[model samples]
Target chain A: MKLSDMQKDKCVRVKSLGVDAHFLNRITSIGITEGTTIRVVRNDRKMPVLVYVRQTLLALNREDCEKIEIEEVA
Target chain B: MNSIALLGQPNSGKSTVFNALTGARQHVGNWPGKTVEKKEGSFTYKGAKYTITDLPGSYGLTGNSDEEKITVDYIKAGHADLVCILVDASQLERSMYMLAEFAGMNVPSVLVLNMMDVAEDKGISVNAGELSRRLGIPVLPFTAADGKGYDRLRDLFETELSSPHLLTSAPNLAEAKSLKEQGEAKYTWITQMLEGVTTTGSLDYKMSRFDRLATAPVLGKFISIGVILLGFIVAMAICMPFMMLGSMFPVLMNEPIANALTAIHIHPWLVSIFSLLIPNTLYFSTAMAAFVLGVNLVFGYLEEKGFIARTAYQFDGVLSKVGLQGKAVAPILMGFGCTIGGTSGTRVMDNWGQKMLAMAIVWAVPCGSIWAVMPVISGMFFPWWGTLLVCVGILAYVFVLMWFVSLVFGKKLSPVETRTGMIMELPPYHKVHWGHIVKEAFYKAGDIFVRAFRTVIVISVIFWVLQYSASGSLEDSLLYKIGTFIEPVTKIFGLGWQSFMTFLSSAFAKEAVLGVLNAIFVGQSSLLDATFHAKTSGVEGMALAQIMSQTIAPAEALALIFACTFNIPCVMALSTTYRESHSLKWTARVAAFYVGSALLLACIVYHIASLFM
Candidate 1:
């Protein structure tokens, strides 16, 4: 499912990033690669999706999150 | 002396480390032609002197933004004897990406695991020796804020500078030409390097109540406004004392200078300059410096404490309408205090285009002086309700113009790629570091003060000369002749030469517009004469308002108010804009845009008002 579709408190593993090269590189450089675990801290609509990744909190724009594919960690 | 370069991602406490290393010995200037700051300082450690260059922070040496490009180019040029890479020990997994990108650069480096105290609080610990062994470099765990472990760091620095070690276990660089490939390989390498060297306790991730309230869509706006207003009041509290001190300069020095010059048998024009103009210029520059210092101190504290970043996240959706991110909010809010501070504050933006756009939008926000001048001027001609209506109209019009400006200039400044997405790291809230905040405030304010002093001195001297007259006659001065020559064209905007001249002087400084109007419209020869008369009368504000209402027509007064309100803020703002953007062309373009649109706005308002009259 798209990362943007994940609700708050859900843990998901990054399956693939459907973004362009620059964005893909940017996310990867920030430690959000495939198989990385991310917890959705705040996924409120109309707001950037706040997530916990690699001991850091990241705010990703919702539009960009829509392009990111993830799988339920369980 | 050996040289070391500090590199890290944003908010890795690189600045604190730099400040601790080089207390008051640092020199800050622009990097050659770029607006990015270059900070170089020196420190003596155990009788060995070392010069350090604090490179601009970047996510990685990806050459994407100007900061990153400068870092990449600086490193490629082999400028540093040893590169000191700082990473947040609490978040080493994410922060190590820079070291991963630097793996194959073949430069001698030492890894600094900063924020060790924070890491310990999080129940995480790093075996620095093991990590150093794996990375083939010396590693030192440190807490920059507390400033402990510096002795060990100095020893490690000494050892690294004497015998540099290149990374032997760097990530494989084969087939990693593209940024995507490089990022993947780097992250893979970072994971492998951290294996068994770092232990992390399982920490549940949840938004605290405070953060939840701070980022709520509806409530966050009100809360942020309250918080920002409180911040502004605190800034004013800090600023008012300095401003009060500055106001005394004219009173204290003006009479002494006047007596000194007159005793020397100087011409009245020369006497006016030394006595009135010089003191006035000093007073205004001091006011500017004080405001810059206050705004920077308060906002810098907010930024340092991580609240500003939260505000950015909170307002990103709203500001995105104007092709700007949420980070522009602080600077725009600061524009109300002083545009020069706001312009310099635009550095917080991610891209140059956004910085330029943010600065342009800041020009639309009426500054502190404008707020003072607009109400009094509007109140002079119109009744209280009429004045209220005009004030509201001006604000609404400003909002419309800002939207229009973003549409017209946004695409040119910010490209689609730069606007693709926001991937910002929201740092944890930390206590304000007072030492760093004050030093930065003074440093930034001082930089602006010097530039402003240069611009003010030159402009005021020329202004004084043009307005100088041997005989105290308004028409005899060169400025009067120029004003009359331009009167015909300016009349289209419902302004007489006196009002036009007032408009012109407002660009030098906004509050001076009222004084200029009083001088010229009341048939005084020079601004110095108007000031002397006002000082003798002891009732300048009320008397001037009465005289202005009689001297100028309602339409003309309205036009002049709008025109001056929208003029290119001030000479200092222009210089600050140039300093921040470092693009003469864009700066001039924005300035021209304001002047032309300001006149156009005046003309439209005047014609529309005349129709009703």
Candidate 2:
């Protein structure tokens, strides 16, 4: 599922970031990578969904969030 | 004296530590490549002086931007003897990446585990000695805010230590040509080095009730609105004492200067040149400048505490819907405090189109100076209801203007650059230190005062001169002729000759409008006599607003208020918009847009109000 589709407070593993190279690199530089664990801390509609990645909160607009694919962990 | 280059990721409490170290000795300027600030300072320690240079914060050394280039270049250039690296102790996993990259570069460094109090509160115990031993560096755990463990950190600064390479156990880098490979190497090394040396426990981030509301999507919108309203209301409240100052303003600034000038027995014309007019205009501008400065200090304090980031977060969706990014909110919020600040504030956005569009839209917001004078003018014209009407009208128009201009400019200035989404590490709320507020207020106010003083001094004098022609009556003045020339055009917007003249003269500085009026409109040629004449005359009130209302119709008065508020910002904002955008084309386009729109808006308001009349 796209990261934007995930419910708030759910932990997921980042699979791949289908974004522009420059943008993908920026998020990656901040310790987010494929296979890193992240939780959707805020997923309210009409607001940028905030995700908790490695003890930091990042706010991603829906346009950016839709490009990142994620999977639920057992 | 030893030189230390302070380096860290953004918001690793580097600034707090820098402030604690240097106090007020910092010199701030922009870096060569980007508009990002370069701050350096010096302080005395035990009879020796140490200079500190704060390098731009970057996530790692291998990014593509100028920030990455600048940081790497600074480190490799060996400008400082030792690099003082700061990292948040609680989030060692993420913050350690910088240290790993620095070690990879083979730079001499000492690590500081800052915010030890926060880590201790979270129950994350850092074995500083063991970690320091493994890293082959002195790691001093510290909290820069209240100077916890700072003495030990300062002592370590005094002692010479072996240059530490914390990635001692990492394997040699593979001969990978990919940029990704170099970044991954540093990332992997950080994890490997910290494996046994650091342990973590699960601790939830403490979110306040206000934070929960502010972060919630629906509630967040309300919270943001609440914040904006609270900001406005507080500014209004703070303006109360200053408004009292405004009442006594003519008495203090105008009366004395006018009185001393009257005592001079020089020729009348020469006395007019050297009269209280020039000095009184300067004084009036100083008061207006102070009002803007005070409002911005409140803005700066909130921005320091992270309210602006929350504003960006809360408005991200709405801004995106309008073809802008969430980061656009900061500049817009700053537009309330001051438009020039708003225009200059857009430098942080990476996209040129976004910056231009943001600046163009920010012109719609009525700035602090407008707030200062509009209240006074509106209260004068319509009494209590007039101020309310103009304020409510401006607010409604700002929204309409932003939407309208976006449609006109948004397509061409749409976001073409894919920018990094902001990571909202909301700063922990702290009690505001009044000391810091006052210092910043003066620094900011002093800067603006100097600029306005320059502009207003020249313009107000020209305006003062224009109050007289060779014929010397108020009607024969160059101001009257030019005001007559524009009166017809401005009359379409319900503005008369005096209002038109004030608008033209005020383009140099808003406060100069009242200054010019004091010299010209009452035909008394002096502020004190003008007040005295209006009071003794059948006019019920002695205030300038009362005299102004007797001459201008109600419909015209409302239009004048709207026109002045919505017009192009003062000369200061014009030059600032140019400097910040660094494009004469965009700056000219923005100024032309505001001038055209403000006039058109007033025309519309005038026609509609005329129908009601």
Question: Model 1 Cα displacement at A39 (Å)?
Answer: 0.3
Clashing pairs in 1: none
By DockQ, the best candidate is 1
Ten consecutive residues with minimal summed lDDT in candidate 1 chain B?
B530-539
Best model per TM-score: 1
Candidate closest to the true structure, highest lDDT? 1
Model 2 CA lDDT for position B563 = 79
Question: Candidate 2 residues B1-613, lDDT tens each?
Answer: 3888888886676776776677668776557645445779998878778888888777766666666788788878877777889997867777887786677666567889876766676567788888777777778887765544656766777774333333354424676455555556766666666666666322244467877788887777777766765765565566456545644644565555546767875555555444445454445445545555556565656665567668778776677655676657766876887676666556445345677788888888778777876676666667686578778878998888898888887876773342345544554454444555555556555655565556555655665566656655767777778888978877887778887766665465555445555555455544323322222233223456657767877777777778777777776676556544566666787788877887787788888988875
Note the residue pairs that clash in candidate 2. none
Docking class of 1: medium
Model 1 residue B397 distance off true place after TM-score fit, in angstroms: 2.1
lDDT of 1 at B362: 94
Could you give candidate 1's per-residue lDDT for residues B1-613 as a string of tens digits? 5999999988888888888888878876668766566889999999999999999877877648677789888888999989999998988989999998887788899999987877887778899889988988888888777745678878888999988998889887697786656677787788789988885323377777988898787798778777777777788788789878978878899899999989989987778777887777677777677877887788878887788788788888888888898988878887887787677678677556678899999998888878877888788888899889988988888788789778878877765456656788998777565776787778767776777777777888887777776677777888899989988999998888888888888788786776676677665435754432222232266677777777688988889889999989988788888767767788899989988888988999899988885
